[model samples]
Target chain A: MDLLYQIFVDPFVQMGTAPDLLVQTLWEGLVSGVLYALIALGFVLIFKASGVFNFAQGIMVVFAALTLVGLYEKGVPAFLALALTIVVMLGLAVLVERLMLRPLVNQPDIVLFMATFGLTYVLIGLGEIIFGGDPKVMIADQLYLPRGAIDVNMLGGFVSLQKIDIAAAIIASLMVAGLAVVFQKTRIGRALRAVADSHKAALSVGISLEQIWVVVWFAAGIVALATGIMWGARSNVSFALEIVSLKALPVLILGGLTSIPGAIVGGIIIGVGEKLGEFYWGPLLGSGIESWLAYVIALIFLLFRPQGLFGERIIERI
Target chain B: MRMKQLALGVALAGIMAAPALAQNSIFVPLLTYRTGPFSNSGIPIANGMHDYLAMLNERDGGIGGVKLAIEECETGYKNEKGVECYEALKSKKPVVVNPYSTGITLALIPKASVDHIPILSMAYGLSASAQGQDFPWIFNPPATYWDGLSMIIKYIADKEGGLANLKGKTIGYIYFDGGYGLEPIPLLDQLAKDYGFTVKKYPVPPADMQNQSGLWLNVRRDRPAWMIMWGWGAMNPTAVQEAAKINYPMDHMIGVWWSGSEDDARPAGAGGKGYLSLNFNSVGANYPAIQDIQKYVIDKGNSQTAKDKVGDNFYNRGVMNSVIIAEAIRNAQQLTGKKEVNAEDLRRGFETLKITPERWKELGLEGFAGPVNVTCTDHNGHHAAYVQQWDGTKWVKVSDWITPMKDKVQPLLDAAAQDYVTKNQPWPKRTEACDKSS
Candidate 1:
């Protein structure tokens, strides 16, 4: 009976986060949610295009950011290094088209995903060779990111929000909107969507699958680069960046792989939900529940919804 | 047939070469976490180890002109991989093992006792390793979690003017949910029982601590007078930010040595100003050893850290770990007469080490931790620590070196170590190795 009290009843009784503290806690969750969503955006972009989960997306972020920083450190100007990183990502896209995608065309999705696992290792080794293994503080000051926070009055309380976080949220929303416009309105976007819908049908329609693969991958690479720079500014850029990227798995589950809107909404929900959960309920369990909270939430969502909030309902032909 | 003949021939040649090759240099097995979540900190440490060996070779022509050989196997913080690395390297007759992870060190404790290989778990590993009589082969120089926790509690007590003032005051503890974070719990509990403070604990889960509302909300709700944190890696930054969010005064927060780093501070730069953490070694753009590191390690392009990131707290600790290993080997050479000594020789070296203030100054570590004097009964050679506050941009020393309640801590170390032995059913044989005197 005492054990039961310790396990369940005692936890809630101890809850006493003040109103101001509650608002601030929610703000942290919202900020972290944005970052998690940014990482998941890259995975969703690739998964939607190729039907192959890009395991190397996380490393790509680290690798791209590291390359940019390393080149800048080598006396190359920041803007120039950023340009060169784009080129590197493009070169990588071309290399993937020629070496991986083209060669393994028509392969099973599992095979393609496994090949990405191989790619992750290759990038890790290559990145380490090109840029030595070490964590680097992002050039936030150089990148001109706003530092410090603004205290806002709310619910007879106050909440502090970093200016850079606001900028990130704005930029991420724009980028997603831009991608949606490109996919819906632009010729290349339609071709890519066609390829996503039916690779055989897209080929029959005379769309050069090779061109679409290169273009979509290069676009994903750009997303990865942006995600890297933003997250790297939060902490030092290092191989550890890869671990942070793994948080996207729960985000992807919450947001369906096939639905872009799902990724956006799901990422925010997981991010905000985990924070709120940690703030409100973490004390009951002795804290540290935020890590697994997203997966637990996603699992529960799966049980009820089956399809994600915005995802298409499956109609099995069988 | 040809493959078999060639393999047999190669095996025979290797066996023949083994006896012909003289073992003049000591082999130190490095169990490094150079590719894990901790690698942000570990890579620099491994680089420090390598550069110091290079420095020895460059400056002294190698431990009395016999040279030092170091072979590192990357563990990435996996205990099983660390054990595999230890097994793979032990056959090479290593002088000692310096495993960077607490998990790995715990795994190696039994292996070290059985294999006769001494381990140097500096400022890490099991908190009870300070009880050298029980832990025959383990050396935790410059205190343990118990020592660090006492120092913080002592400082807090001193600030409050008396132990009695702690009554009804809640003390918050946010620690990682692992053995490394758990080490200070027993000591904290004892102090709370004695001091009449209500203890509130919040455990940070690993790799998933970015959103830490659960922990920080608890601190705000409890309204603790002070918070002591024992966290590492992502846990540090997240905890700091969460604390800042809940408007917890960063100045009243205390972190253990492992949790305090430039990387850890930068994320919470907004709310982290004046956050105090214990420092066994001071770090910054200053420090003479950092000059040696920049000149020898980074300049040579052999540094494991970015050239700009040198002199950061964890990077300096990496350099210090290498210094400890090198100094031990140098001390071993004095007693053993052999230029290259084995694990037993290094054990004696660690036991008899007398790194005075002058030696530290000469080694370009004038202000790092004043001095470390090793003894058989006390494996933690140095018991002194000072407080450093992250002043938004850098770590600045805020207090003189203060020794914790050693009289109170020693008995706890002894008792816990005895419990470890009894639970593990280790033999009651006395570790007479301390008396061998080479």
Candidate 2:
């Protein structure tokens, strides 16, 4: 009975007594959720278009950030460096399409996925060679992102919110809204949807599968650059950031691999759930639960809805 | 066929060239990681180690007229690859092997005995390996993790008036959830019991190193009077940032030596001011040995180190490590009367090594490190360390060298060493005489 109360009653009572702390924890969860959502958005874009799970998406985040920082270190203006990074990413998309995707066209999906794994190693080596494998301070101030924190007095206590996190949340929302417009209203959007439906059918209807692949990859690279900036602002920019990409997997699974809105919702659920578990109930289990709680939540969800919350339902006929 | 004859001839030439290569120098394999998540810290240290040896070669024509052949095998900080590097290089008959990571040190400890190579782990490895009676092949001189933790507690006690003032306070320990990070736990727990304090532990998983908001929030809620961290790599910067965000007193928060690099505090910018960490090495390039390295290696563009990273903490620590190894080699040569000493002679050199104040002055390393005298029974030497604080720009020594609580730490070391020996049954007994001259 004592153990049960500690498990169920104590956490809620603590939360009630310290509402300010509760608010602070929730805010942190939401900010982390936005970052996870951005990374998942990148994965969803490429997967929807090519039916390939690009394992290189995480390294692409590191590569994009490294390129920006490396160029700036060489005395390039910040805005010009940002522009050049985007061009480099676009060139990378073209090169990847030409060198890897073009040769392996019409191959099995697993083979294409394996090709992305090869791309991951190549990018890791290239990034290290160019950037010299040291952690660099993010050029947040130069980029004009907000610094410091704001403390709000509410619930008879103070809750602190980092201004950079608020900025990241706002930027992530705008990007999602802009992506939604692009997907819904553009001519290229229609072609992308047609190709996503059936590559051969889209080709037969004169959709140009190759062109759509490049566009989708470029879109994913842009999302990666945005994520790299926000995350680097939160911490330092290093290859260490590559490990955090693993956190996006549960977000992708929960949000459904094919849905943009699902990625955002899924990210928030995992992030908030993970933080809450680590804070309130973690002491009961000796702490360190944040590392695996997101996956556990996704695994439980998988039992009931393997198609995920926003994934398209699959039908099979015998 | 003619192709087979050509292949045979090439193989024969390689075999014939092997002895010539061996006769030219002594091999010292460095298991280093220059590209990985840990590379931010690893690169500087590896460069320091490499440049020091290069300096020795350029200035002194190597130790005793034979050039020191330093071969680097990249492990990327992974234990499996570290073992693979060890296996690949053991055949070269290296005089000593420096396994940089604690994980790799733990993996190589048992194998070093069979391979007859002395494993020099510097200040980080299994603390119990200091009990040279049981583990003769592994050496971690200058200090051990237990020594580091005891010193931290002593410093806190000194600041709080006395050990008695620590009775009712809550002390938080934030550590990485790994063998290396958990090394000081037993000593901390034992000290807490003896002093009547409450101990709170917060573990940062390897995957969660960069994402530590939850852990910091708990620290705020617990309201510990002080916090000590056993973190490395990306975890260091993140922990400092989160602590600063929560308005934790930077001076009251301390970290182990691994967490004290410039890479750790520089990311936090101005918010990282007054952060303190323990140090077993000097921090600047003012020493004569360092100046020689700069003149001989860096200025000549013979070093892989960046010019700006010359006086950094981890880089200087790496140079200190090489200083220890080079001294051990010189000691072995003087004792054996042979320029090329084998692994057995190097082990004797480590057991009887002495780096006194006079020797430091001679080596042009005055004020760089405390004197380290490794005895037959005490491999760690129990050398003292000082506290250094980050004063916004760089680390400055804030306290004199404080000795560890040896009376309290020795019994724990003995028990842990005995536990290890019992677990790994049929462990070799130390049959060699301690008083024998090489």
Candidate 3:
């Protein structure tokens, strides 16, 4: 009975008693949700265009960040390095189209997935060779991203909000809005949606699959760069950042793999849900459940709604 | 017939070349990880370990007239890979094996006696292995994790006035969720019980090292008076940054030796000031030995180390690791009177090894680290460690060397050792005789 009370009754009581702590946990969860959604956005863009799960998305984040920092360390101005990094990502998108996708075109989805595995290794080796294995501080000051925090006193206590986190939330929202407009209102967006619907059908209608693939990959590259900067500012820029990208897997599953908006909602749900679970209910299980709690939530969502919240349902007659 | 003859001829040639190469050199295999998530920390230590031995080979013509044949096998900091490296290198008859990881050391402990190789975990391994009587083949010099934990507790107690003053205070411990983090928990819990303090744990899984905001939120809620961190690699900076973000007092947070590095602190920027961590070796390139390393290794372009990172904390720690191995080799040569020492001879040398303050100066490493003396009954010296505070830019020594409470630690260590032997029944008793001088 006491265990039950501690399990169910205690967490809500604690939440009710300390509204400040609740707000802080929710804020952290929301910021983390935005980052996870950014990574999931990258996955969604590529998956929508190519129908291939890019296993290399995680390493792409590390590579993009390393390029930015490595170039800056080599005496390139910060803004110039950022521009060059974007150009490099474009070059990478072209290279992937020419080398990996074109060669293995029309193959099984698993084959393209395996190719991405190879791509992950290649990028890891290249990044290490070029940037070395040391962890580097992000150029947050040079980028003019805000630092420190703003503490709001409320409910007889204070909730501290990091300024950089606020910037991340703002930037993530703007990017999502811009991408939504692009996907809905532009000719290129129409081409991308048509390609996502059917490659052979889009080709029959005179759409260039190759061009669509490059554009989507380059867009994903931009998202990865944004993510790398935000995450790097939070921690250090290292290959270790690649592991955090795995958190997006749950977000992708929770948000439909192909729905951009679904990615955002799923990211927040997983992020907030994970933080609240670990904070209020973690001591019951000895803590450290944040790592797997997101996946567990995703699994539960999968059982309930096979197609994610914002995903379009497909119906086929047998 | 021709193919068979060719294969036989090549095999015979290889057999002839093996002994010829072994006659004039000593092989020391290093288990390293240079391409994993942990590689950020591993790379510097690998470079330092390699550079120090390479310097010896270049400057002094190797230890005791025998060229030191050092080979590194990448383990990626995984235990299974570490065991595979051990299996692959055991055929080369290495004098010693430095696993560089606690999980790998735990996996190799049982196989050490059967394989006739001494495992040098070097301050990071099974803390009970410090009991030399129960485990003769494993040596962890300088200090064990439990010893380091005890010293950290003592430091905190001193700050709070006394151990008795810690009665109502709650101490938070954030640690990596692995053998290296868990090894000191028994002692920490015992100390907490003795002092009437509550211990709240926050374990960081390897994958969640960077995603620690939620954990820090809990820290804010619990409001522990002090936070002790036993973290490594990316976990250190992330924890520090999150603590700073939550406005946790930086001075009240302390990290273990593994968590203290330029790579760890520099990433947190100015927010990381006053964060204290324990370290055994002195930092910087000012010592004569480190200067020699720069002169012979880095300046000559023979090392992978960056020019500016020559005397960083982790690099110096790696140099200290090699210094122990080199000293043991010299001691073994003197005792056995052999130019090429085998694994067993090196084991005896490790058992009787001693590095006095005078010897440290003689080795051109004056005041670089504490004096280490390994005896027959005690493998780890359990030496004192000092606290270094990160002052936003660099580490500054903040306190005198604080020794472990042996009276408290010894009983737990002995019981742990005995429990280990009972669990792994048929464990071999110590049969190797100690050196007379030891």
- lDDT measured at residue A65 in model 3 versus the true structure, 0 to 100: 96
**Model 1 spans > 4 angstroms off:** A1-25, A315-318, B1-22, B209-223, B237-247, B266-272, B282-312, B334-337, B358-368, B426-428, B431-433, B436-438
Model 1 Cα lDDT, one tens digit per residue, A254-303 = 88877777878888888878877776666666677877888998888988
Ordering by TM-score: 2, 3, 1
DockQ of 1: 0.40
Residue clash pairs of candidate 3 = none
Angstrom error at residue B164, model 2: 1.0
Writing each residue's lDDT as its tens digit, candidate 3 over A1-318 gives: 999998889999998999999998899999999999999999999999998999999999999999999999999999999999999999999999999999999899999999999999999999999998789889999999999999999977999999999999999989999999999999999999999999999999999999999999999999999999999999989889999999999999899999998999999999999999999988888899999999999989989888876777779999
Residue-wise C-alpha lDDT for candidate 3, range B296-394, written one tens digit per residue: 878899888998888899999889999999999998999999989999999989988999999999998999889999988899989999999999999
Provide the TM-score for each candidate, comma-separated: 0.90, 0.98, 0.97
Give the higher-lDDT candidate: 1 or 3.
Answer: 3
Please tell me which model should have the higher TM-score, number 1 or number 3.
3
Model 2 chain A weakest lDDT span, ten residues long: A189-198
Q: Model 2, which residues run further than 4 Å from truth? A: B1-16, B435-438
lDDT of 2 by residue, B123-223 (tens): 89999999888888888999999999999999999999999999999999999888789889999999999999899999999888889999889998999
Candidate 2: residue pairs that collide: none
- What tens-digit string does per-residue lDDT give for candidate 1 at B286-384? 766567656765677764566666667776776777788888888888887867777887888888776788898888777666688777777786478
| Poorest stretch of ten by lDDT in candidate 3 chain B | B32-41
